[model samples]
Target: MELSNSTLSSVAGLQVVVCVVFTLIFLVGMLGNSLVIWIILCNIKQQFSTVMLILNLAVADFTVLITLPFWIYSFADGWVFGAPFCNVLLYVVHCSMYASVFFITAMSIERFVAVLYPFAIQKWWRRGTIGKLTIGIWVSAFLFAVPVIDQKATHVEHPQCSLLLSSYRQQKGLIVLETLVGFVIPFLVLSICYALVAKRILKMTLQSKSKSMKVIRSVVIAFAVCWLLYHIINLLTVSSILTKTSSPEVSKMLLNISERVENLAGALAVTNSCINPILYAFAARRFQNGFNTSGIAKLFQQLNISIAEKFSNESNIRRDNFQTSV
Candidate 1:
């Protein structure tokens, strides 16, 4: 469809809005993740598995946030950076996305194990297990993202970076793979984990678990809110493709609609990167009083779940009674 000059002008304005939103996400995500990572590394004393998981998660989020500038430029102008870099960016972004979700799933499962089978963890779970799992997550992400390498390009008019898969089967398969591996499996795992955790915690309340778990739980919810739309759009695209079997015009229309709505979905997917740090800040509750050091920094020192065990016997309800002030 050819855009008239007026339409082009309107699109240009909309592109500016997209760029602005992306830039804000980039800045906030980078700053928040950076601050958390720095404090975790330099300031926080006790480095437990939970902390390591968080550090890895922040790094994963940060990796994707760093790639947003290229995307912002791509949206505002075009893919002037050439196809090679575009392909690399696609791989990194995709890999990081997979890594982030996998890390969340890992954290959830770890928390489950810690809650249910404490003895197994005490006996068999080594300190380096999470490190190895971190490595495996990156490797698995790379393997999952391998298909997209060199597949992205400036195919359409105005040179936007897009996935231009050559085969219909490949496109359908990519959607299926993403839906299953990225969304469905993780959703099931997390739902089951949290269901059991909630069952156990019903008597315990949020106070029974450390705020670290609260932060992780909030991150899981944010991830769902952000990426759920993207996956739904992916399913709709698959539906469109399947609909072509009977009604070509209807399929074309559905495809067009999906395409139009897809930009916003993609933006939300990246928005999850920034949401984590904001959740971390809230979980830190750093603004409650004057602090000599970073409130976020102080939250890390007492992030362990075991620290909450002492509260199991207490009947009085006060979640913030022991809150630290830097």
Candidate 2:
């Protein structure tokens, strides 16, 4: 599978294209997600389960955007960051991916609970509890990605970071683990949760229809579609590993196709971050108002007035007390 100079140049050109696409997606995603965070923290008052879930989702997306420069550099000049930095970068990237999936699944569950068992939420779903669960999600994602840290390495000769195990047996095992734990399990959970949520929304009272169930459905479906494509590509990669024969040329072609598909899927995954803020703006009335002029401006004005009043009252009280003492 040795590459000639021309072939190497061609691959470098392809990588440059990928780098530009990913960088653009990452920048737009960062802006949109940061706006979502600001709107949630500064303007939104209700702080429901859905809000918390959205916050966590934004956090995961932000984490990935923060690490994008490292990946962009890797694509541009190969993995010159050495083995340790490569390991850390891969670990962070995978951790963000896992965390993103888990948070989306959590959002589905929260929607299901809010729609189906609204009364039960008061008993179990508090802000503190959701915060704790978010922490657990981060910890779980980090642990899940620990194996990748050990399994990934930078190839000094080719200057590419990739999975360490090139052996068929090891690759098969890793692919199985990745598919089951990383994709299949999370997808199943999210699908079931969304199913229940849809059923609940359908059966809800008239007031519930006026809510943002339609928007929620759209967001969930978009995420599911993106992840489904990613998982399908992963399945193909696994198939490539399993069907590997002694034909070097055929094997190289299959590997190249798998790698290209994987790059496309990764790009699609980054698109998810950008989609979320748009979903929020369009789907939820609160988010729309808070993100726009009326709600956010009014909130800042009210805050400033309250602070001024508090200070004025304090000064008045101090003067009165001083006069009385004199």
Candidate 3:
């Protein structure tokens, strides 16, 4: 069914709702990610690959959350920010988006390695090497975001920011590239890593695993679901654009429906940034133990899950050394 002008007004109203919702998400994300970063930096004596990965992920999420105010404002009002500023902000958003994906995927790979080749990790994956790799990931993410610089701000009825090129061929190419690189490949890698980890976990008793493992599983599942919906909507929109060749009217209808759905898909995609810290609060034993004095700690403590096995294992090692010296 074709939507009338009233339906277009409803879409605008939904965009306003998106602004309010995104603002709330930003506040919560900033608080949660900051706490995660603080706990990791202040309390941890020795940094491991896991620590570095989590720290980077928190930083990336924080960076993304910070840019959200501009987006919220632009959604509610028009894009008052000039083209250069809009482009820069969009670039930051894209970089952080990909960085989150990379870091999450890295976490899964790190877990898979830890579970599958514990001894090899110490030898093959040095902390310094992992740190360097994290830097490389950030640099690559920034490079991936270079396409945003081409986006220009236009003011006709109202100021709007959009792609400079409106060619159907170029738009299709860019969308296909984004879907393949941004969504498909990283997601596939994440799934495979987690599948291997899950296979290994199944061999062990439930009690033997860490609570953080379950948290990781949940994060992966959430990422998959949210981004899967986001990308499906994107593909549908792209298909609709392609259909202009056969039937312009049908294409216009599909595009209108896609536009109406865009807010929900975008919200789902942005939600990944807000979920990481909550996962840590509930599932990460070290986070609970390290921040014991805080209110958040109380919340974490109430979560009835086993402590991470690494903490207990470290204590065991210390006790063994003490006994050997005696």
**Top TM-score prediction, candidate number:** 1
lDDT of 2: 0.69
lDDT of each: 0.78, 0.69, 0.72
lDDT of 3 by residue, 85-159 (tens): 767877788889888888888878777776766655565454466878798899989888776666432222243
Cα displacement (angstroms), candidate 2, residue 53, comes to 1.1
Arrange candidates by TM-score, descending: 1, 3, 2
Cα RMSD for candidates in order = 6.4, 11.3, 5.6
Model 1: lDDT equals 0.78
Error at 270, model 3, angstroms: 1.2
* Candidate 3 residue runs with Cα over 4 Å from true position: 1-12, 151-160, 205-208, 284-326
Higher lDDT: candidate 2 or 3? 3
Clash pairs, candidate 3, are none
Per-residue CA lDDT of model 2 for 1-326, tens digit only, reads 45688898888788988899988988888987898788778776656566677778888888888878877877787777777777787788789888887888787676666555554554455437777888999999999887767633323334456666656676577667767876788778877887766765565444333244554566667777676767777677666665667565666666787777887887787788677766655544453454553443343333223323333544676789999999
